[model samples]
Target chain A: MKLTIQNLTYSINDTVIVSDVGLNIKKGEFVGLIGPNGCGKSTLLKNIYRVLSPDAGSIYLDETDIRTMKSKELARKMSVMIQENNVEFDMNVLDMVLLGRYAHKKMLGNMTPEDYEIARKALEEVGMAEYEERSFLSLSGGEKQRILIARVLAQQTDFIILDEPTNHLDIQYQFQIMDILKSQDATVFSSVHDLNIAGYYCDRIIVMKKGRIIHCGAPEEVLTSQIIDELYHIRSEIRENKYTGRKQVYYIPNSANISTCAVTENL
Target chain B: MAAAGFAAMIAAMLLGSVGIQPDWVVKILANHLSRHNIFSPEWEANKEAIIWTLRAPRVVMAYVTGAGLSLCGILMQALTKNSLADPYVLGISSGASSGAVAVICYGWFRFAGAYHIMFGATLGAILAIVIAMKVSSVSNKVTATQLVLAGIAVQAMFSAITNAILYSSTTTSDKLRSAMHWMVGSLASASWNTTVYVLIISLVCTVIIRLFHTELDVLMLGDDTASTLGINLRQVKIGVIVLCTALTGSIVSIGGVIGFVGLLVPHITRSIVGSAHKRLIPASVLTGGFFVVICDMLARILAAPEELPIGVITSFFGAPFFLFLIRKSRNSFGGKNG
Candidate 1:
């Protein structure tokens, strides 16, 4: 499915949070949305997922305008793993995952054997199959994030939008979650903070600054020292690691900057 | 299950009051159905009066009120997503009491008959709900705390009104006794007509609620989640509230303010069946009916001729159980972390 976000503008009161942002995600591609804090990555993603309506322009899932689609129907196509979900009630983990099947099931319809099978497979994919009977609130943060990913997998959507899915996860879990998304061959659009993880996982990257797309291209093209400095106002260096033969990027603290150093060579 | 409940209530009808034998009770029921005044029988005269006029209606009323309150409790709990919520949490019962107090004090009885009592009670309940809704809707999201606080405020206001009228009336003693009888909660006035009325409303409302149990389950997860799942939050919330208030109004009209049944039964049902409303709801209705019947039976047997208030019986049973359930829920939810 092609996901196209067209010329979107969003504002809260008079403050423009996301301005004239757009992206075209082809079928089965892994894309990252990276930006500094307060640059409206979450706001832009929220608009695409229909959590926040854009002040202007539109999102299209292929030819279907997302704003016109029923929320349930849209949910069936694009599942989301957002930050900040807390449950005050205790629900069994399996039951929580089963709730993902809700959009597919009719209001009064009982879950079929197939639905249970799909949920079980999704749980197994996240290696949380054995935790099905455990209380959802008992899981650690990383375990909970995995369970949430499993739930979205059960949602059976070809497109997944994750807003900071690795927010509180340890390094191992961060990779594990990204790996699961990578293996799924699903169209994965994520807002990521850790630049290294974004470098390793994303096929293409979109960089935003103050609600506008500052750069958009393959990870290597967009992860330039100049664009990084412009977006974050920090001096940085991007280089290829000789031993690993992978792109390596690191930042230098402000106190270490030299007056004679070139912008790209300072790190 | 409905059959079992009906059968249990029938069995309860045999166990209480002055010496109406099981065979005689059955004959009275049958013969009464055949259009004869069972009171005309050559059987024991005192027994006939006791069976016909007193015990039977009381039992029926107890059952009706019990089922109605429990059903409303379950619905309101689901609606508000607060376990502490009940039909009275909207101050409807206090409003009903205020209206009933007015009728009893003003001697509107001669003109109003039962209509004045039922109408006044219903009007009071409706007014209380309107106020609760008003207070909560000042902000778009109605938090559990807001609803409870509004309920407390309205309840206090209505209680003051009831008290003011009680103190000033020349007929204070008589009105106070009747109001106390209503407040303490009773099935003392149950008759065939009243039983029929309670049955129709409770049954219809219960069925209607059961049909929407799935929607109720979705709504309990909070509005944003429910809306994402394709259920319109505003319409469903209003509709359920109206339905619950209607059932509550009916119960208050007949039985006055029976406390804790609504608050207690849903939690009990949740523990038994988990939080799935499809199972919890019907289970709540049956369990609620059974609880009221048992409590009513106990009320009849414990004090015999004097007749204890059904509310007294429920609170007696429900209060300690409430404390225990709260403790258990606190443990299950792992204390304040949520």
Candidate 2:
């Protein structure tokens, strides 16, 4: 399904963190949001996922205004995976994944065999099917993230949102995560930090600075050396990847390190 | 666990200040329940009064309070999303006692007749929760240390309120003594009347909480995950708060502030049953009942003929356990702590 937002503004303690941002992702497109640290990319994703309500704006999933939907109803349409927060308790891995079927089950309903099958298939997709009975807290960070993706997959929504899904993973695991996300048949919006990864996976890249959407277009069009310098303030080279012929950004952190964004913002 | 609780209750009835024969204890209970002598009374006449008239209801009160406290602990843990959360540790019981004292000191809420203390205690429980949560939740997340410290603050504040009411308003020594029961927690005054009321309230709350076993499990994954997984976060949290207050209110009105049963029983049971609430709830309730009954039995015989407050017994076990838990889980959530 298509996703839309209009005039979404979110602030904290009278300071605007996300200011009057508007954007959309057409059906089945993989859209990546990229920006400097603390640019409110995560916050904007939160607004769309209903974790943080926008201060003065609207988000729509297709024709439906998100505000009009029940939390459960909204969850059925779009699933979200944020940075892993520590859990105080541990459950079996399969049970954690089966949490996705909650919206499909009644309040007093029992999980049917079909629910287990869905969870198992999602686990298989994430290469976690063998770890189904292991303690959730026992997994390594990257493995835990994969299991989380399993949960998202089990949710089976056509729309998905991820907030920095590969923040602390090693290079190979990071690409593996991006690969898994790209392979899903869903309208995906994710906050991504690696410019090369974004260029490789995203159909469109939305650039943000100071909580506002500054640019949006096909990755090849948007990842110009000028725009990279514009958004990040550091020097970077944009060139075609040898294998894929896609736009790739190679960072030269030492070159032209200066800000022209006209704001003294926290990074 | 249920059978163990039953056995412990019977053992408690047999072991009080006076040891009534186990055979007579059974006969006394059977006769009382069927409203006739189920078996011929072959024991001393006063033993019947000791087993049926007095000890039976008292053990039942201990059973209910123990189970109630355990349920409150489970609910509070889920509510705060912190395992360390419990009614007594979080000062909910003290707040409840403050309400019970206010009612006792001035005979407030007399319009509600027999249920006045329950209402007052319920309000007090709610106020305590609000204060504790308000202080503990400076960050959106309530960590183990923050929750415990906030509970201590709320506990101290409400304890002072209870004492202030007891000191200022009580004109007679009798009022002071009865209100003291509400402070330290005792089943000494538990009769069929108060026992029945507490049992019913605790049962209702327990049933309601048990129904949310799945929701509680989901909530452990934290608020954002829980909400996205079809939990109406506000509604579930409110339901937990309301029921916990009601349960704490009634138990405090009748038995005073029983400390740590909620915290101790749930932890021990969780270790055995794992974290699934379907198994945890029933097992913890039964274990809580047995734990308290045993504790009360010790409270009775250890000071034979002069009973210790049930809180003294539970705190003896709970306070150190609480400290140990803190030391163990100090680094469980690390961003907030050094």
Candidate 3:
């Protein structure tokens, strides 16, 4: 249940994208990774998921080395949901979700009714059960991302990794997706693009800058104004939300004059 | 679909230059299958001979060639993750053609005798695709546009080799003429021997591909996602490539370079059955069979005894469809949002 990374480094053409990173994620922890664009958050996740091998160091799920196990065995424990934009082919939503059961099936296995039941429930969890019969390509961007999340849910792994799960979603959808991920029982490790979203849902935040981990702790400790300025070089006002009781941030542009210091307070 | 395939087969056999009776076609098939003369020969000896020997093997070849080419299309599309990929578009067909032509002109693989063309065709197909794939790939993956462009390059080169061998054979004989017929893709030389060989290969390939239906489905999700989903990426890809190349080689050996069936049939069936290979593969196989048989029948009856090459008939239909698909795909890909 514990995922450990020891001294991991990954490089492409000798230009390191993930460098000497180390961490341990305990069972059932909601961990968020935050970094500026191209700061190697995705690359670090890829290394953890075995999509890319590190030039040094190793990862273990509990006592087991991930490198020694077959991909099927690894998939049984860890599921990954990277941004899936272009499918290029049309298929029924249910069938697409059912692909998550691939690691569990035998070579000549058929899609049993039980499998369909699991897929249906997963879709329902994402509020996409009614769209199961629809062509996957016909769905909107938010709907497609939901279906992909449903696919990950159907995978039924105890641990999951998501890379920028809501990069382009509208604010309405951004909260809905975060709500769904938070509601899950799995140990969730994700790269989060929106700082406010991460602050609201994530139990702990890991901040990366220039291919290295700069800070890691509770969101309140890690997402401070100083760290935000240091990481992205932007001025930001931070406060605890009165409603949700979590940290919330509002940015201050140098050109814009602030009438009041508290942007959220007025609302 | 099965009924349609049976109907198409009957029509293909009955509508040839020799007007054979429908009853005779069935009885002839029965006799061949049972390996006994179950029905008395009420028809002329020529009619029975035409049904059992000439037309039966030709019609079977038509179906096998159709099914095999379509399967290759599905595999290529899956392999490159591009809808436009096929044996013809990827230059695998032209590679097989060049190999087959070399065998015919120089009587190469004389040691292997009857099955030499298939081996040569397979070897040529492997070589052409290796070169095409090597050229098309950027980093570790092949993009849709680069694959098609590389395919065109491979196609042009292999076609040149085939033509060069055809033109440079100093002796003028039936061997050269038969090679010419095959070069353009005709079932005129299809016999019981080659038909059995190709039929076996098609059936085996179909079964193998069927086993990977789930893997192929995952593959459509993209390479990175599929592997994380537990698909042994290397194993599935190698399996698909080997099966596609072998089937393409055998198909060329029998039917020469029949184009567009491989490109057109899978797309058509995908539209009807959706993109899951479990449904799409079987549907494409049957639909492809029906398509080729109808086309073969047309090749026979189109200009009477002077048979047009089956490729000529298929390209007449397939070329327009390919252009239409290009425009359609381009439209979807044109905007940043598509």
Candidate 4:
């Protein structure tokens, strides 16, 4: 599935949180959204996933206008994994994953054998097959994140949007999550805070600053030192590692304490 | 569990102050059903009246009220995504109480007679829910915390108003006692008509809620996730609130603020069957029916001549059990671990 956002703008109480932004994600591409905190990466993604309505723009999945499409129809084509992990009830893992099939199931129908089969496969894919009967609240943070990924996989959409899905995971779990997402043959649009993970996994990276897309291209072409400095107000160097041959960003701390105003002026 | 509930209902019917023997009770019921006496021809008229007109209707009312209230609790908890939510949490019982008190003490809506109280309570409940929804909504989104806070505020405000009306009324002690008894919760006024009405409402509401079992399950995951999974949050929230308000309002009109059954029954059911609404709703309904029937029986038998209010018994049992549950699984209620 192809996701096309044209001049998407979102404001909160007369303040523009996400200004006019345009991007087109091709089918089966892995795209990363990287920006400083509060630069509207999550807001822009929320608009695309139907969590927020863009004030004066439109998003389209293939040729269908997303605003006009029914929620179930849009959900059939796209699934979202947000950062929220707090659940009000103590639901078990298998039941939670089975909820992913909600859009496809009939109103009063029971979960068929096929639904359970798909859920089991999704759990297996996330290596959480044994935890199906376990309480979701008792799991560690990373385990819960992986289980949520399994739920999105069970949703079986062609496109997936993730808002910092690996926020609370350890290093190994972060790589594991990214590896699972990388292996899936689906169009993925994820907002990643870690530049290294973004560079290592994404086919293309879109950098946003102050609600506007500042750069868009492959990791090596878009992630220049000047753009990084401009985006984050921090001195940084990007270089290819000898062992992994992937771009890595190394931050350079100031020798002396600098005021926030000075740093902004330098940028 | 269903058999146990049925047995409890039979016991409630048989063990009241006028202890009709099981054989006599069965004969009375059979005669009423078949419209002819097949067993004993010399059955006492008073015993037949007690068995047919009094205990049986009250028992059925107890069951329906329990089923309806607990179903409302389950829906409210899921709607607000808060485990502590109950049928009365949204000021609904207070609203109903105020309306009932107004009708009883001030002669409000005097023309409706037997239905005046019911009409007043239902209208008050709807008003309370609308106020809570309006107060909690921020922009176009409603947060769980805000909804709960709004419910608490509305409840306190309505409760104060109810007390004010009771304090200022110039009615005689008899009317005061009746209003007080109703407010404390009683099945003393249960009749065949009220039982049938409650039974129909409970059945229809439970069936409609059961159809949205999957939607309710997704809703427990939180609003954002529910929307992402194709469940419209606003529409589902409104549907749940309206259904629960109707269910809780009708029961309050008949039973008068029967507390804790709605809050505790769903927890017990969830602990047994997990949190999937498909299994949770049916199990909660049966357990709630059984619990209330047993409690109502105890209320009658505990104080021999004068009946104790059903609400007191439920609170006595429900409060201790609720404390135990909270201690056993603090995190289940989303409480932070110490």
Tell me each candidate's RMSD, in Å, in order: 5.1, 4.0, 2.2, 4.2
For residues B1-338, what per-residue lDDT tens digits would candidate 3 score against the true structure?
87898899988889876777788899988987998999987898888888888998999999999989999999988877778888998899999989988887688898887889998998889988788878877765666667768999999999888877877874567556665665569998899999999999899999989888998999878888998888888888888889988999999998888988988999999999999999999999999999998899999998997888999998898989988887777744434323
| Tens digit of per-residue lDDT, candidate 2, span A70-165 | 878888888888766568777778988998888777777777899999999999998889999898888888988998999899889999989889
Q: What is the C-alpha lDDT profile of model 4 across A207-250, one tens digit per residue?
A: 99999998999999877778888888777767787777989886
Question: What does DockQ come to for candidate 2?
Answer: 0.56
> Of 3 and 4, which scores higher on DockQ?
3
lDDT of 2 by residue, B1-338 (tens): 88888999999999966667787888789888999877988988888877876889899999999999999999888878777899999999999999988987788889999999889999999999999988887557777767888898999999999988887877677666765687778888888888998999888888887887888888878888888777888888888899899999999988899999988999998888767677789998999989999988988989878888888999999989988888888785455441
lDDT of 4 at A87: 76
Instruction: Count clashing residue pairs per candidate.
Output: 1, 0, 0, 0
Candidate 4 per-residue lDDT, tens place, B1-338, comes to: 89999989888889966767777777777888799877764667988898889998999899988888899889877876766667666677778777776776677786877777776777777788778768866664445556557878988887777767777774566555655665668998888988787788789999999988998999887778898998878788888887887787778888887877888899889989999998999999999999999999999999987788998998887768756654564553334421
Quick one: best DockQ, which candidate?
Answer: 3
Count backbone overlaps in model 2: 0
Best by lDDT: 3
- Docking quality tier of candidate 1? acceptable
- Per-model DockQ against the true two-chain complex: 0.26, 0.56, 0.71, 0.62
How large is the interface RMSD of each prediction?
3.0, 1.5, 1.7, 2.0
Tens-place lDDT per residue, model 1, A1-267, is 879988999999989999998889999989999999999998898788776789998899988998788767887888888753534445577776777787788755777888899889999999999999887768999988888888889888888989988987899999999999899968999999988788888889999999999888888898878888888877777878676565778777688755426655544
Each model's fraction of native contacts: 0.14, 0.59, 0.80, 0.90
User: For candidate 4 chain A, which ten residues in a row score worst on lDDT?
Assistant: A258-267
Candidate 4: segments with Cα more than 4 A from true spot: A255-267, B34-38, B100-116, B136-149, B163-170, B319-338
TM-score of 4: 0.91
Name the best candidate (by TM-score).
Answer: 3
lDDT assessment of candidate 1: 0.76
